[model samples]
Target: MAELVRRAGLPVSAEEAFAWHERPGAVERLLPPSAGIQVAQCSGTIRDGDRVKLQVSFGGVKVPWVLEYYGYEPGRRFCERQIEGVFARWSHERRFEPDGPDACFLEDRIDFQMPGLWPIRSWAERRILRGLEKTLRYRHDTVAADLAEHARWRDRPRLRIAVTGSSGLIGSALVPFLTTGGHSVQRLVRGRSGEHEGHVVWDPETGQLQADRLQPLDAVIHLAGENLAAGRWTAERKERIRASRVEATRRLCQSLARLLRPPRVLVVASAIGYYGDRGDELLDETSRPGRGFLADLCRDWEAASRPARSAGIRVVVARFGLVLSPRGGSLAKMLTPFRFGLGGRLGGGGQFWSWISLDDVLGALLHAIMTDELEGPVNFVAPEPVTNAQFTRTLARVLRRPAVLPVPAWALRIALGEMAREMVLPSARVVPRKLEQTGYPFRHRKLEWPLRHLLGRQTPE
Candidate 1:
């Protein structure tokens, strides 16, 4: 096998560098956009025993490859080997070494053999090495720049913002936005068993959070909770869901109350599901929560944060609508079906769907952080709400596919049980009056505009 080694440096801790390397589904993120990389399956931590299946673009052709992580050590090094497909033999090792107090040295060594005879293999190896170098250099520069940015502002006079679920969908996007705008963030990671040093560990079951870790902060944005629609809401699943939000929030708020220097603001995420099945009602911030598992969970979730509010924290409950992104979430799941001409309307298609682009979701979060006047409940949704039919049509149009079929509510109910009724059939025609009242303009006010941008369409003047 031909071997190649490259070294670079970043201005972040060995831990931070390792964290970046170990982010879930990172293979797709690292691959060049031109590569048209689609992750089939990726599991386990990137630091160890990870497996990934990907459809990678080679020139104009797409090739599938399965990669296996053979070895790894946090803040130090990791290695990957191709288990199946494409290359005759492939292996890569990534090393992160501390260079100084705020600098890290990164090195990557790769050995690979292409599927070809000697002369052809040699030529392909040369070309692939060049491409890999260019790509790796870009990645190194990108990471180093990010490290430099964090370093430049890490010590700035700013709010010591601590957030749970800091590596999740909402947190991932919002962290960068917060950092760029001069805020320091600490992740409140859930540790094994009980508590970890320097981390605000919490037991959602017992409603116990490490309150001592919270002190003297400008803001705290709580986005932690179990995903609502991940699985069937069995008795056990329902308990877990309720406990995840209510108990977690209760612990966080209680902890905030104990803080000598409590945060100025506590931005908490709720859901429009609070207004369950609001058929045509133009629900706003003042709308009372409806009856249901999700609605009750949201109500209790918001109520649990009262301790912080009582302690003079500006608690803002942001009720999020459907969040759309090309990268992940519900939209990403639909992309494949829509791309292959299988998209269709759900239920009678009359149920209004209030949605927001992921970028705007982050923007609204940032706005709430910056705007002191934005206290209490705020609806985080697009100005333009559409019916399920409209959403399907728009998506299909964007994908250049046909949306002729209509999924009956009965069928969905039979398949997904109560989940279908709650997640799909219910109509939440929410309006962001509070957000608009504060003059927080939406980056993507309408679905069509953002859809075009996401689908790689250039706007015409």
Candidate 2:
């Protein structure tokens, strides 16, 4: 059998830190996205007798693993024993001890042995153990960061929040963050055929919503919209994009405004598209909107939420930048080619790509919802905006691949049509001026940190 132990000191009490792990979404949060660990089924939340079944992917092949909780000392320790899995034996323990009035020591230990012959078993064990190191390190960092972020807002009352686009990249992450941090989440999905509009609570097609059902909520984060880069932007596809954001948001806001006791705050997702191609100008919330289709769509989309703003709700228009994550979006699409050293800049490589980590996107969203100082057109981006060429090089460096090829602007325009011109190939040097001024602690400020984190790559010398 092999044994491993890791330890860390947290700014929060042992009880407080332990409570974080026991929360609803804590387990999922700890499962690093890059590791490809998915919870198949869960019976309870880290309690004795609770069982969890997981499918851990190994080079696209999923291996089933099952574990049952055993030792459960409240605010102190818990243990999980492998019932059926890849290993011959597996046992994991989480130990937390108080250091001082406001500090805690955390210890994680694992014992396991591979179930095969000597040489093969040793090789597999070595590889798995290395992965375990990275996974645990990520968990520790995430726990510390989350605890700090939550502690800052501990004084604020836990909120009951509703989220649209809960399945989308940002919304999916945001939900887990909110739930684990003690906020209640109510997912507002699109309406289905034959289902009553009131039951669904949102059907932007005909502007129908169950206004009465939204009462007594503390916040609403509206993130529903069509994918801009899902395909070439034909005239029809462009209209779909416009209607999804502009029309749906307008209708959703109208419904929220009609609620008897509407949520105190509403966050509507916009994009850096609000400030179209502004080659090298550094922009902030104070910057004016740019010209073109995306800019116009963004302008109308934000305006569509007028009913909620006019009805006394504190409205936060979040203009998101290029969100970096390995799970989905543009980054996911680029990974394969980049890994093969086929990755290159999209256009002239001079266009700015104001990017933010998926982690920071979640952080900024939570900050926006909690901070009263942030209301209108908050830029959710990193401090530094990298040009397309810079991003290409950085990604290549992270992947240990050389990026020498470049996709010409003309080729992109020929292939993607108007989308190449506006969405994909525009330059917007957007900075999170408002977020910084309001003290929104960014988890990542540079291009490399998040790329490395999301990709599970090691930090360089």
Candidate 3:
């Protein structure tokens, strides 16, 4: 059998570090985005005989891996062995060794034998080891970041929160984040009462929800809305977007206000589009809304929270810039063309595009719910915004691709019509003023490293 062992120093106690792994979201948080590893079945917590199932998808192929846990010693070590998978024989042991009350070490030891004859097995082993280094580094970094953030809020009480659009990009990540942090999450799915299965029932379209269910919640995060870039700006599409944010939010908030005991905090997702095309202007929460379909919608969107606000709910309006992750959002859309070396700036490449990694977005949301001081509009973008040209160049550098194909304004306008002018070519330089003031620990403070980390392109450091 071949062996691969890796170890990372943890800043927390061995027990503390072990608990983080024992939680429900360890697999989700640890897996690299580019790897496309899907959880067929997740056995939450480190327990004897618990089984975890995974399918690795690459180049349009799915290879299943089943792991059954054994040596489950809490605060010390846990072992998992492959029962069914690609490798001929495999065993993994995750051991947490204590250094002191404040420090520990996570040792990941793997023993496995590759399938096939000597030459083929040797080549496969070499390839796997090369890729494994990057993945392990990412896991170590993620664990460290998460530990730091949780440490900051260590004294705070755990909360029971309800989230709308739980299946959406942000909500999906946020749920696991909160759950792993020891907070209970009740997903607010828009389905009939009995159909909820276990989720909280709520339908903004019909304004139906059981107020009693929300009475015990500590916070509510509303993220349900039609996707802005889903299609061209047709009249019908515009109405759906407007109604989804304005009407849906208004109805939901009204329901919350009427609750016997409403949640203390309510976080509503807004967009940097609320700032409109400001033409190189550095915008913040205090900045007035600019003129546009988006800005107008945002005005009404925030106003819809009046019911909740008037009822003493701490309302935090998170005005998000482009969220970067290969899993979804604008970054996902850009990946295909960019990977093929066709990425380039739009128009003059002068317009600023403020953005944040998916990690920061989730961090900001968690901070919002936890920090009582954060209220009203808060820009949730990286402190330093970049021009379209700078972003293109950085992205190309990360992917090791040359970006020579710049999409001209006239062509974009012709192809995308109104969307090309409003979204494709607009600029808004935004910064997270409230998060900065409140000392929200940003996991990704810059772009290049975050991009590299998310895409599993980390260079030796």
Highest lDDT model number: 2
Choose the strongest candidate by TM-score: 3
Which prediction has more favorable TM-score, 1 or 2? 2
Residue 156, model 1: Cα distance from true site in angstroms: 11
Q: Is candidate 2 or candidate 3 better by lDDT?
A: 2
Error at 412, model 3, angstroms: 1.7
lDDT for every model? 0.77, 0.88, 0.87
Quote the lDDT for 172 in model 2: 78
Q: Write one digit per residue (lDDT tens) for candidate 3, span 140-217.
A: 988878887777788999888999988888887888788878888888886665554448788889778866555388
Across residues 128-206, which tens digit of lDDT does each residue of candidate 1 receive? 8877775676456546644453444455465677777766778866665455434566667767523433356656556
- Kindly report which residue pairs in candidate 1 clash with one another: 216-261
lDDT of 2 by residue, 1-461 (tens): 78889998898999899988887778778888888888888764999999999998879899999999989999999999999888999999999999998999999999989998999988988888898888888888888988899899988899988888888999878877888898888777665523522123578777777555554789999999999889988789889999999999998888888888889999999999999989999999989999999899999999998999999999999999999988888899889999999999988899999999988888888888899878989998999999999999999999999888889999989998988899778999999999999998888888987888788788776
Clashing pairs in 2: none
TM-score of each: 0.68, 0.95, 0.96
